[model samples]
Target: MSFPCSDQSIRPRKMQSASLPGVMEAVRCWCGDVCKVKEVTDFSDWLGMKFFMCANYESDPPESISTYVRPPSPPPLCMYYRWIDTEMPDWAVTEIRERGRRAWASLDLEERREKAEAEEKAEQKK
Candidate 1:
């Protein structure tokens, strides 16, 4: 199926029925703090998935986020989580996995190129 903004496979975000269309509805965590709506942008099958996350939640430090922001994350308060959208279809899952594979491979190539360039610079400095 197709959507006006994105593919049907794209994760949907929960929002207030009465509020603005794009405004996300507030979801409180176990601690009564409003949870943050986050999207999985990493190279994985779950990419583009939207979920509610506790502000104090942490999976593995900086690596948990695709483009991690550095500010010394606070201790996790709770592990509350809820998916906003339904699970993807089999074809959608396969497509996402393939995209993720290509993305990872591209990143590896870029890293290798940068490393080689750095080595060249070091040799020139010697």
Candidate 2:
């Protein structure tokens, strides 16, 4: 299931290109690298919109690094991209906002539950 944009407690993930439709073709970036389509989950009016971004584009990583099995991918070669879809409708924006709110609320509850359980376990150990 897709999570909300506001709830960043979980890591963001990339949807496989195989599931993408209508964007079939060899779309290349200005840097001559193949571009990948990523969906907008920022919980804004643009939510669910797809865009073609450079495959080499690496967004800013989190400040803390939990583990590093291997070196991360290279940085963005060229900041070139194009939006696949146009402006979203009012109804679509409203729907996306509501969905995002619900998603974050559910995730918040789950996180609180997990934290409480962990605290209880620690108390028991003590």
Candidate 3:
């Protein structure tokens, strides 16, 4: 409907809610560790659904929020299929790289274990 906060001066008609059934869902950002699921009523421009984003961005909004544009009613921004597509922090990126390296090391250890198992099997056959 016509939200008082929306730029109603331009469009006199109340904007219809998009067709998608929107819902509250957990969202995580690159800069923060907490993943919070807020209600649509919590936002002003929320038509129905929208993508998750850092609300603290430079753009000043009438309402205080921590995410980007909320979606209209019809096409709900299905958060279940969404991901934390953000610019990762340098430390977090490094941490992920380290974890990947550790994973590779674990794989190498498994290879060695397999080789030892093969050697033992051959010895038993001899």
* Cα error, candidate 2, residue 39 (Å): 0.3
Candidate 2 collision pairs: none
By summed lDDT, which 10 consecutive residues of candidate 3 come out lowest? 76-85
Candidate 2, residue 103: Cα displacement in angstroms equals 14
lDDT of 1 at 4: 18
Model 2 residue 119 CA deviation (Å) reads 39
- lDDT tens per residue, model 2, 22-116: 64564677779887777666556565666666677665455575448546676556765566656764666888778889999999999999999
How much lDDT does each candidate structure score?
A: 0.59, 0.62, 0.39
Please give the range of 10 consecutive residues that has the lowest summed lDDT in model 2.
1-10
After superposing candidate 2 on the true structure, give the runs of residues whose Cα lies further than 4 Å from its correct spot.
1-19, 23-26, 63-75, 89-94, 97-126
> Each prediction's Cα RMSD?
12.4, 10.7, 18.0
Cα lDDT over the full model 2: 0.62
Which regions of candidate 3 fall more than 4 Å away from where they truly are? 1-74, 77-87
Best by TM-score: 2
- Of 1 and 3, the candidate ahead on lDDT is 1
